[model samples]
Structures are given as C-alpha cells and as structure tokens.
Target: MSIETWLAFFVACWLISLSPGAGAVASMASGMNYGFARGYWNALGLQLALVLQIVIVAAGVGALLATSALAFALIKWFGVLYLLYLAIRQWRAPAQTMTLEHRPIGRPLSLVLRGFVINFSNPKAIIFILAVLPQFLDPGRPMLMQYLIMAVTMVAVDLVVMAGYTGLAAKALRLLNSPQQQRLLNRSFGVMFGVAAGLLATVRRV
Candidate 1:
C-alpha cells in the first residue's frame, strides 16, 4: 500500500472502530463489570477475532462467505442469537463494584472467550472487510505487505477505541455506588446489546 492509501485506510479504521456494535458494547460492559485492567483482556481477545476475520478476507474465503446467502444467513442469525444471549446475561447480572481480585474464578478466560465469540459471530465483519480492504490495495506493491499494513492499522485503531470505551465505562461505574444505580446502568447496556442485535439481523450483503 502506498502511504496515501494506508492513510485513508487508517482513517476508515478509526470510523469503523468508533461505530457502536456488539464489540463496543461488550468492551464497555466488561470495563464496567471487570475494571480496565481485567477488561483489557477482552479487548485483546477482540483483536484476535479481528485477526481471524482479516485472515479470512486475505485468504479470499471472506468473499465466498459474503456472497453465499446460506453461509451469510447462518452466521447472521448466530450473531443475532448470541447478542440476545449477552443482553439477557447483562440484564440479569447482579449489581456490584469491580476490583482486581473481585472477579469470579475463571472469569478471565470467560471474558476473553466472550469477546472472541461476539466478534467471530458477526458475519458482517468479514463482509465489511471484503468490501472495504480491497479498495486500498496497490497492484504494484506486495499484496502481503499491504494486507499486513491494513491489518495492523485496524487492530491498532480498534485497540485504542475499545480501551477508551472500556475506560469510560469503568470511570462512569465509579459513581454508581448503589445497587439500584448499577442495575440501571447494566440494563442500559443490555438494551444497547439488543439494539445491536437488531441491527445485525437486518444487515444485507452488498
């Protein structure tokens, strides 16, 4: 990729990362419930999921996934159902403050897995990458290098954005000392997740 092309992709990455979706909702929820230090693990897992999607795109399977209505529909429904599950879990979670040692046993792995699953289930991710990443490719340059640059840019942007979401939620939770207030905050996130699911379910392949 040329410097100019890479720059454009970088800008696009910022917008994509900043868009509210299941990943963003999960990041904020984790931060609110797990604290930033622990919440960051989920962010890392989300990066891993992004890596997987990029790989699928780079390998050309993403095109097939995006074009195949059966595959796309299957993954779309899975994402919608999974988001609903997360929404219910968030709504039912007990109100409490988060601390370093306060997480449940094995919660770290659970958080990471949750992040991975949320990202991986979104068929739109692969489709979006397939639709967008190719526009910046330089036929004259090494394709592998171009893919690497794009992947790095995306991961870097998403990491920072997700961290911000997590940190902001963690900070907001600090003032929510009462159970009632925490419960309200939790339900709001749950509602956000439901909205994200609705949006995901309505997505159409381009």
Candidate 2:
C-alpha cells in the first residue's frame, strides 16, 4: 500500500476502533470484571477476528456469503446464539475479567481457541470487512498484498486502542468495592449482551 492509502486505512480503522462495538464492549467487560490481563486476552481475540475478517474480504469469499441469504442468516443467528450464551455465562459467574492468577483454569490450546471464538462468532464482523475493505483497494495493484498491508495496519491500530480502553476500565472497576455493586454490574453486563444479541438477530440482511 502507498503512503496515502496507508494513511487512509489507518484513519478509518482508528475511527472504527473508537466506536462502541462487540469487540470494544468485550474488551471493556473483561477489563471491568477480570482486570488488565483478561482484557488483554479479550483484545487479542478481537484482533484475531479482524485478521480473519480481512482475510475473508481479501479472498473474495465475502461476496458469496452476501449473495446467499440462508447462509448469511445461519451465520448471523448462530452468532446471536453464541452471544446469548456468553451473556448467560457472565450472569452465572461474573468472574473478574482480570484474574491472571486465579482465573478460570483451562488448557492453553483451549483458552486460545475460546478467546478466538468469542470474537469470531460475530457475523457482522465478516460483513463489515467485506463491505469496507474494497473501498480502499485499487483494482490494478496486487490485490492480495494491498489488502494484506491494509489489514495488518488495521489490526495493529486496533490492539493499541483496545489495550488503552481496557486499562481505563480496569482502573475504574477497581473502585467499586461492594458485593451488591458487583452483582448489579454483572447483571447489567448480561443485559447489555442480551440487547446486543437481540439487535443482531433483528438486523435485515443486505
């Protein structure tokens, strides 16, 4: 990618990162409940999804998914269900998202995969990548390389932004000391997740 293209890609990505979305919400939730460590894993999961989204966009698989109504809804609703499940988990346990020492003990491979799936289950991510990536590409250039460079830049920026958000949230959550407050906060998060799932379920396919 040329300098101009790089600048544009970065600027757009920066704005998108700042927007409140599933990835940001997840990162913030982790930061609030678990602490910076869980927030970091959450952010990692989010960045991984961005990589997948860009890859799908670059490979032109996006168009196929878009054209197939059944396929799109299947993925979308599946994403919704996954989000609901996550919300339920949050409600039941409300584990501190930053428990580096006493966190839910699991296998390393499974932890990594779980983190990845948490972000990848959102179909809107794939659609967003497909719809937005093409606007930055030039048909005459090496398409793959162009997208590769752009996507990498995007993911890098996103990581930085998410980490910062997580840090701030972790600090804030540390302030609330009461058990009642913690319970309320967990319930609120569950509600937010449910609302998000509802929104996704109701979205009209484009």
For each candidate in the order shown, give its overall lDDT on alpha carbons: 0.87, 0.73
Candidate 1 Cα lDDT to native: 0.87
Clashes of 2: 6
Best by lDDT: 1
Candidate 1 lDDT at 23 equals 93
lDDT of 1 at 60: 93
Q: Look at candidate 1 and give me any clashing residue pairs.
A: none
TM-score of each: 0.94, 0.87
Alpha-carbon deviation at 24 in model 1, angstroms: 0.8
- The TM-score obtained by model 1 is 0.94
